[model samples]
Target: MSKDINYLIKSSIEIYFKNSQIRDISFNTFLPENRNLKSKRSKLKMEKEGKNNLRFFIESKDITAFRASINEIITFGKIFENVLNLVE
Candidate 1:
């Protein structure tokens, strides 16, 4: 990844929740150098190919509840991204 892009993503993650009370969102960038990226959300797999990808993992057992959660998350995420872009 380009340094600038990586800086932007790390900056976004750091800046987004710095003053918020949210705790469900977290990340890690440390590995032994051989482990592939792995995370579980909604029983699906999210692949990481570059620094520009924004991905999250959510899990739910109930189909209806899961759909509702997905909708809420996506809505909020879009709004948040828009706000971030505006700030830029």
Candidate 2:
């Protein structure tokens, strides 16, 4: 349930990390979330409104976060789940 569900994660990362140049994020191989992100496609909790709410499906996958203690790369694995809450 992670094929399409990943868009949320992707969009969140893309939107949040817009300043960064990381481009290897995807349903197949994303950030620390890939640790157990082996599921299916989905779009269960999207807040699509109006005509946009025409019943759409999103990709799904587990959440990933890494431990980058190198300042710029930084580490946020501790609050990774919290980050997911923000996007989801």
Query: Top lDDT: which candidate number?
Result: 1
Instruction: Mark the regions of model 1 whose C-alpha exceeds 4 Å error after superposition.
Output: 1-49
Lowest-scoring 10 consecutive residues by lDDT in candidate 1?
5-14
TM-score of each: 0.35, 0.20
Score residue 58 of candidate 1 by CA lDDT: 44
Candidate 2: stretches off by over 4 Å: 1-13, 21-30, 41-88
Local accuracy of candidate 1 as per-residue lDDT tens digits, 1-88: 3323221111111123442222222222212111342222233222332333434444544454456445644565666667557776
Q: What are the lDDT figures for the candidates, one per model?
A: 0.37, 0.29
